[model samples]
Target chain A: DVKVTQSSRYLVKRTGEKVFLECVQDMDHENMFWYRQDPGLGLRLIYFSYDVKMKEKGDIPEGYSVSREKKERFSLILESASTNQTSMYLCASSFRESPLHFGNGTRLTVT
Target chain B: AQSVAQPEDQVNVAEGNPLTVKCTYSVSGNPYLFWYVQYPNRGLQFLLKYITGDNLVKGSYGFEAEFNKSQTSFHLKKPSALVSDSALYFCAVTPLFKAAGNKLTFGGGTRVLVKP
Candidate 1:
């Protein structure tokens, strides 16, 4: 069984504060992803990493950045958190052509 | 660009009744389609996928999906619904590009309500 674990389940941050969401996967997958889930907009991709220190911006990468310094760990960074960035942040990892295994998700509330 | 669409926002069915959640996709070449289920406050769980070969793909929890090439549909189905089956389901499609790094295009998701 593959296991992906997120750093937090719920978080609250003040406007303009820096936020970091961490994720770790036990499966040694080569691909990792960050997504934000909203009610009507669905799960929009924020960023993804294919290899260590290799990152790609997704559809909605604004106001978000990601780091994959280590194989098992990936971190999402919000340079300046805003209310609009508040969302259910999900982390996922997978090997090529394989199904992604996702962490439980971190619901962040920016006030 | 590749995209996935799950037409229904919500599906309600009685327990023991067959249930379906519709999904359609658009891709340039042979598409890899998948279905995932998410419980409240949880991450998405893989259901099944249609990569190649057979159109009917069976997955966890007795869930199956049929990939229709003509209709561009991959509708999820189950013989009988259980109350525990109530959850949010998402459909996803993989792009044809190898450089895409296995990123998945996901639908908005459909909420399933199984009533006893």
Candidate 2:
């Protein structure tokens, strides 16, 4: 089974602080993705990486950035965390454009 | 450009009764459709997908989906609803909505409520 692990299950940060959410996959999938889930909004893609150091912006990339320095790890970075950035963040990986396996998710709260 | 629409915000059903969650999509090329379930405070889990081939595809937890190409719909179904089945259900289509890429475009989501 594919296992995707997020660095933190829950996190709290103050407004204007920077935050990082890490994700690692054991399957060495080529594609990695970051998404945020909100009530009535579902899962909206923030960023995705197809290969090492290769990144692409998703629908809601306004306040997010991503890093894929290695095939197994993907990190999401918030330049300046704001209250509006508080949401459940999910990471996913796939071998290609195939079915994705998702991490448990990190609930971020910005105060 | 590709997009997916989940029509209902919520679906209520009695335990042991049949259930259905509707989804429709638009894409320039053949679309890869998927259904995911999210329990409270948890990430989305893959329920099933319709890539190509048979219209009816079965998946985990006694769930199944039918892909109707003519109607541009792929709806999730279950024979009997269980109390544990209450969760948020999302339908996704790839590539992203209004983009010619490989990312998935998820519907706003549908909350399923199974009453006892």
Candidate 3:
């Protein structure tokens, strides 16, 4: 079984604060992704890493950055958090061409 | 670019009745389609996937999906609905070609409600 773990289940941050959302995967998968889920938007990709230190922007990557210094870990960084960035953040990892295994998700509330 | 669409925003069904959640997709090459269910406050859980082989694929929790190349659709189905089945369902797609990368383009999602 594959396990993806997100560091926080719920988070609250003030505006302009630098927030870090961390994720780690037990399986040695090559792909990891960060997504934000809103009521009508479903899950929009924020960022993804194909390999350690290799990152790619997804559809909505403007307000975020990502780090993949290690294969097992992927971190999403909000350089300066805002209320609009609040959503249910999910971390997922998968082997090449496989279905993604996801963490429980972190509900972020930016105030 | 690959894309997926779940036409209905929500689907309501009575318990013990059959349920279907529709999904359609577009991609330049062969598509790798998937269905996932997200429970309240939880991340999405994989339900089924269609890579190749038989068009009808069965997955966890008695859910199944049919892949139709001509229609470019992969609609999810279940024999009977349960209250526990109420959740948000998302359809996602990725191109079969490696050049497209492993990124999945997801649909807006369909909220399933199973009423007793």
- i-RMSD of all predictions: 1.8, 2.8, 1.9
Which pairs of residues collide in candidate 2? none
**Candidate 1 per-residue lDDT over residues B20-48, each given as its tens digit:** 99999999888888899999989999999
* Shift of residue B104 alpha carbon in model 2, Å: 0.8
Kindly report which residue stretches of model 3 are placed more than 4 angstroms away from their true locations once superposed: none
Which of 2 and 3 is the better model by TM-score? 3
lDDT of each: 0.92, 0.90, 0.93
Q: Residue A6 of model 3: what lDDT?
A: 99
Indicate the docking level reached by candidate 1.
medium
Model 3 has a DockQ score of: 0.64
DockQ of 1: 0.66
Give the alpha carbon lDDT tens digit for every residue of B16-105 in model 2.
999999999998778788999989877789999877799999999999999998999999999999999999999998842323234888
Ranking by DockQ: 1, 3, 2
Worst 10 residues of 3 chain A by lDDT: A36-45
Reported per model, the fraction of native interface contacts reproduced equals 0.62, 0.57, 0.60
- Residue-level lDDT of model 1, residues A3-93, one tens digit each, is 9999999999999999999999998899999999998667889999999999999999999999999999999999999999989999999
lDDT of 3 at B3: 78
Chain A TM-score of prediction number 2: 0.98
Off by over 4 Å in 1: B96-100
- DockQ scores of the candidates: 0.66, 0.53, 0.64
Worst 10 residues of 1 chain A by lDDT: A37-46
lDDT of 2 at B29: 75
